[model samples]
Target: MPFYDIYSEDVRCGRGASKSGEETKTAEVFAGDEVGFVVGRSAMEPLEPHLIYHNGPGQVYLSQSTAADVREYEGDGNWFKISYHGPTNDSWWSTRDQTGMNFTIPDSTPPGQYLLRVEHLYVRYPIGTTQFYIACAQINVRPPRNGTVGAKTPSPEYMVRFPGGLAVPEYMYEWPNTRLTEYKPPGPALWTG
Candidate 1:
């Protein structure tokens, strides 16, 4: 029940997560669905995809009866990275040629509402000019085809908050440094479930 209105939304999609996200248009998906993550791009960079849930901010996934009993999935900093696309060769990023990304909702995820989050960092200008683009889509996940649900949400060991999760060097500059053989995006590790 903390403040979910990320001011950045003001320049984009605000108003929804401002209150009790329950009012937001929640997209319904099955546990094993292939969820696509996209946030139009003007340059070649990297994007990280994540699925997040909140069970009373302290509780754990208990049952379908209480699956969606929590507030809307918004900015709680609690989330698991589903996937990420970053530099491939020195001159390009693997996601550079694509308009969006396709990711599967973890099959073992408990049935409930979640926030599908995507983050892209633009380091075209290097230091002080880099930009960060973030988008979160609200979703309600049901059980899989087998109708099985996990006893609990993935442990906090695999989860990380947003702002604090992506703590990278403020002076990160990747323009000429594009030839990265090792690229680790600025967030939590990927939790495949």
Candidate 2:
């Protein structure tokens, strides 16, 4: 029955607001058990429609994945509704509240870290739809008493390589104080000077 919080970093309320980035919160839970988490408003205002839904908004997705085998659970394929403030609803204006749903992790799932992807989408007219933002969470599920699973390898570091040799540093050559007429070209004795 461990609890966690999920919220957006830069919540905005307008049509032209940017919707490119998202933040994810992760937790560890046991297999064959229900992992309870909360998604609500951290501030006094709920996530508005104009900010998220430019055209037509749809139900937010709570996707789950695992490192081991994929097994079906009781609430695995179900879609839950999250109540939102309609455009015309004035009774509960500017109040930050949340509705929640319960889902159970499958007992047949493997004992390893699983990923849960949460995305917000909108369906617009003329065009089909697009995902505005996406966030993810990792859950470590323990194996059953008699079950065994393998561990995961760490991710590799990202690097960039230049095609040619490294870029040459810029150098500035300045001539000493001498008139063009007074300057004489270097001869074979230039190295001796």
Candidate maximizing lDDT: 1
lDDT of each: 0.49, 0.28
lDDT of 2: 0.28
lDDT of 2 by residue, 83-187 (tens): 222222212111123232234554444455444333332222222122233333455566544454333222122111111111111110122211222221111
lDDT tens digits, residue span 83-122, model 1: 6666566556555545466777778777776666654555
Give lDDT for model 1: 0.49
lDDT of 1 at 89: 62
Alpha-carbon shift of residue 126 in model 1 (angstroms): 5.6
Query: Against the true structure, what is each candidate's TM-score?
Result: 0.64, 0.32
Name model 2 segments beyond 4 Å from true: 1-26, 41-98, 128-133, 144-193
Q: Candidate 2, which ten residues in sequence have the lowest lDDT sum?
A: 160-169
Judging by TM-score against the true structure, name the best candidate: 1
What is the TM-score of candidate 1? 0.64
